[model samples]
Target: MALEAIKNQETLAVLGKKFDVSPIVISKWKLELLDKLPGIFDRTGSASDESETVDTEKLYAQIGGAESGE
Candidate 1:
């Protein structure tokens, strides 16, 4: 629906009627989607950088096990 709104594929009134939501609510959803789109595509991976840690040793062990099927 938000994509439809962004593409102007249909009027808000039509979308609202089809989805059983108010036109204003649809507009808000469209705005919210627009506002977050940039972050969604952020390639820096900053969103999860703080909470994630790569265990190189564990990864290497897994790779070795997979190669040997053990």
Candidate 2:
């Protein structure tokens, strides 16, 4: 709703009044939404590709198998 209001050329002060929030807050929200808008339809799938799977059991076994040099 705030985004829509912004798009309609409403002043930041007016939007702030309507939403009962500071103009700075509305401005920050608008900026954040704009910054992230492109990721919503990203076709390269980079977001999912960056994730790594971890094996906790393998890690535990390695830790338990290690001998203390003391």
Candidate 3:
């Protein structure tokens, strides 16, 4: 799918016309894509960036003894 087309401010009817797909199909695609957003940050063999392993103790102390939001 074209990113430009996805970003355009077109109605579902217009988008369906341009892509030759029904609005229901387009909505399903959009929903499927949206549902994948969380995996973008999940690290357990997921699509998240960088290594999955980490030293939690060091990270905890460095940030704030188990209270830091970040």
Candidate 4:
């Protein structure tokens, strides 16, 4: 709602009053929302790729250790 109000060019003080929050809080929320907007439509999909694989063998080699099955 705050985001919509901000988009409609409402003053920060008005938004704060409508939402019962401080103007600074409204501004901070607006900034955070805008900062994360691009990630909502991200198509690179790196998060899935990172979670799909775990190269434990390579990790052990890098740290000069062997995978000891205990």
Candidate 5:
């Protein structure tokens, strides 16, 4: 059921209904599964896109010297 939920990208509540578990239980299971997913795959680790940053080298080259704080 966890596998099905992950595979189908369905909500935990949806999977919970199918498996006859409470949504909160399913939510916890989903959290655990997500926590392990990166390790399980090995090839794809998690990364964030929220806070953008620039490489120091690229910043210096592109923006040039003191103004860019390189």
Candidate 6:
């Protein structure tokens, strides 16, 4: 709905009705989406980056125990 509003694919009134929300709400959502869109794509400290710091040896030990029914 917010994307539609941003793209002008449909009027706020039309999108609001289709999504069962008010036009004002859709407008706010559109603005919020635009405001946060940049952060969503920022990869500096993203989950994938943090995942690289995980202790894989610890994880493998846990998995090995589980496989042996210990």
Model 5 over residues 1-70: C-alpha lDDT tens digits? 5566667677766776666665555565567788878766454444554244757796344334323331
- Model 5 compared with the native: what TM-score? 0.42
Q: Write the per-residue lDDT of candidate 2 for residues 1-70, one digit (tens) a residue.
A: 4475559688877776676556665676678788878776765666567555768897455434432210
My TM-score estimates for the predictions, one after another, are 0.57, 0.53, 0.47, 0.52, 0.42, 0.57
User: What does candidate 6's lDDT look like per residue over 1-70, in tens digits?
Assistant: 7899999978988886686666776687789899889977776764766644768797566445544542
Give lDDT: candidate 6, residue 10: 88
The alpha-carbon root-mean-square deviation between model 3 and the true structure, to one decimal in Å, is: 16.3
Per-residue CA lDDT of model 4 for 1-70, tens digit only, reads 4475559678877775676556665576678788778776775756676544868886445334311211
lDDT of 2 at 30: 76
For residues 47-67, could you state the per-residue lDDT of candidate 1 as single tens digits?
A: 567555878897566445544
Q: In order, how many clashes per candidate?
A: 0, 0, 0, 0, 0, 0
**Candidate 3 per-residue C-alpha lDDT over 3-68 given as tens digits, one digit per residue, 9 for 90 to 100:** 323675886567766765555556655676677756756646534545547788874454353233
lDDT of each: 0.73, 0.62, 0.56, 0.61, 0.58, 0.73
Model 2 quality (TM-score): 0.53
Question: What's the CA error at residue 58 for candidate 1, in Å?
Answer: 42
lDDT of predicted model 5: 0.58
Q: Distance (Å) between predicted and true CA of 3, model 1?
A: 1.1
Backbone collision tally, model 2: 0
Worst lDDT 10-window in candidate 2 = 61-70
Worst 10 residues of 4 by lDDT: 61-70
Residue 15 in model 4: shift from native, Å? 0.9
Give the winner by TM-score: 1 or 4: 1
- Candidate 2, residue 11: the lDDT equals 85
Query: Residue 12: error of model 5 in Å?
Result: 2.9
TM-score of model 1 (CA atoms): 0.57
